[model samples]
Target: MVKVKKIIFLALGFPNAEENTIIWTDLVHEFHLQGHDILVVAPASNKTDTGLRLEAGVKVLRVATYKLFDVGPVLKGLANIMLPYQYKNALKINNIKLDFDLILIPTPPITLGKTANWLKRKTKAKLYLILRDIFPQNAVDLKMISQGGLIHRYFRKKELKLYRISDKIGCMSQANIDYIKTHNPKIEAAKLHLLPNWENLPKFEDLGNIDDIKAKYGLTNKFVVIFGGNIGRPQKMENIIELAKNCTEIKDLVFLIIGKGTEFKKLKDNVTSLKLFNVVLEKKIPKKDYYNLLRAADVGLISLSEEFTIPNFPSKVLSYFGSKKPVLASIDLQTDFGQMLEETNSGFWAEAGNIPLLKEKLMLLYKDGDLRSKLGANGYKYMAENLLPEHAYNIICKNV
Candidate 1:
């Protein structure tokens, strides 16, 4: 006989249950498909979206709170700080009375530590912290929050409490594991495991015609290079505009950016101001739409701010691999993501601020179709072998 565990998933961002954005949804849905019971707890996306509901057969509790992202920093911080208490009250009002076997938590808001601890104490479930964004420290690195200040001191306690309470800390990369071990020497190595970001390879019925999709986005006549994810401070999207500025004379090439975040307006304004006709900025679209855009483009782009010290791994690369599209990244050196690209031959990268090197790599891919195909194939093979929700499913289940 096999165990059909009851799981609780906590996240700041989640898509509609029927749709798969290939982030946390896939992993939790994999558990659902495997006959396990799962419940998701998240902040309400809008005014009318509050309370309990069933989504794709899984119970989802959308706590009435401030919307999580795509807002100013002050509002974002308020949302994070209030999330735990908000969730606590929501659970009580909704009469959530199940015994959960395991709880999965991902970080961006470490303020959930208090709630996670309370839940574990109540449900007697093991807690797994999916350590995606290291907090307080990452904020300090970005110069968003001052070190040794009142706010930093408060969040620093939450950070430690989260780690201390989590039965297992699943890091996005080995670099993440090492950084934690170095900075927080009291944390035991036994609990920290390498849990890379994963995605379920989608089964789209129609990818649409490449030329039609390209024309739909005004990319029909150019060798399109696309960046398809959050346009935020951590992404250092300025490097993207700089790359566009450098490539203005390359008439055959165009840069396509599709996503919305804090920096979206700034990037749009800069694109208009620079008169860089080679660049196109579009709002973030559904995952299905993004796949078609991926298919129509010649190359994928990933950019990270140079200020980051955490070994951050953005899951966007998996989308390129799934579509067999080669990537070009300008990212911080702290992350081993660049090295992963080098090892897999999936793409090329330069340190985040290095526009000259980014331009060089972009040209190499732009000129060589054969090389692009080979690299893309290599990435596809790697993703198939290692980056699926099934892999994550096994990791979480076995560990718990």
Candidate 2:
């Protein structure tokens, strides 16, 4: 069989966390191994030097992004929406031309489709739309966009264009494929494939010491439940705060919320004002340390809106499994993550904002070491057998 010569990937978001960075890095590595040249373009949120060189066989270009309205929700979304254009200009400034065989794009307002569309014309690359998050649908769920209005209509057109133009799609779950098929039947069934979230299992080692991190964060001997990474607008956390304030019976269960986003300030302010003793907030820790800390936790927590029930799958579930810890998910039971947890016995499940149920599950997991261990082990086994990062790349390359 003949091989593709070159590939280009564009991720129009901030690159800080290892989880996000590793996806593209691993993809580049895999394609390079298959004898393909790779190019990556990601926009930088902070003031940084522009231009680029090759690293690990893949060329990386970080474009400049302006600070408008201080990373608040309104402005933050706009910034993300504007990144492809910023990236385009960044490419022009650096005199880097991308004429490649394949292109992968992520969705938010579905504007990345525009970038892919442009690249397809220039390079005639076979496009693969990485369905990371469902866009206008998510905004509509969050009430950020009116479903029937002109704004929604505008974004919906872009969403459809993305689906129509891409040669193939990589989705997190089967439900996501069904969602696209239901919404847009024009996409060929053969082109849709499952590309689940994966863990870099070997990069993580057993860091047995938890007490040091606990003491540093004032969480010594506490039954910690961690919700780490990206404390953003989509996370409706007020209900979680109310749980900490009201569910005084589960006092030993300490809640840790780590990571930075637009919601951090308001979340911290509310916790301070209420004087919640058990809930602690902190910035995102270094990657290796964070994974180590996750292993030490009694449970990992994730929340997804009911509106996101169909197409969205939180990667945190896979990360929680990678840490060999059980998940306490506040999400729709109808979705893949919930189904996985229930079927594999990997974690507890509760509806988003269902404080009473969340509290109950948290207490049960904290008290029963055997049950939590069994659940955690189940998830670990699943991830080890199927969901490593290298495995995801193999699947993507094989399909492509």
Q: Per model, state how many residue pairs clash.
A: 0, 0
Which residues of candidate 2, in runs, are more than 4 Å off?
Answer: 14-22, 32-35, 45-48, 67-70, 73-82, 202-208, 307-310
Q: Per-residue lDDT of 43-70 in model 1, one digit per residue for the tens?
A: 7778688888887877788877885776
Give the whole-model CA lDDT for all candidates, comma-separated. Answer: 0.86, 0.75
| lDDT of candidate model 2 versus the reference | 0.75
lDDT of 2 by residue, 139-225 (tens): 787777888887789878888888889888888888888887887787788778898877566355455477887777787878888
Cα TM-score per model? 0.96, 0.90
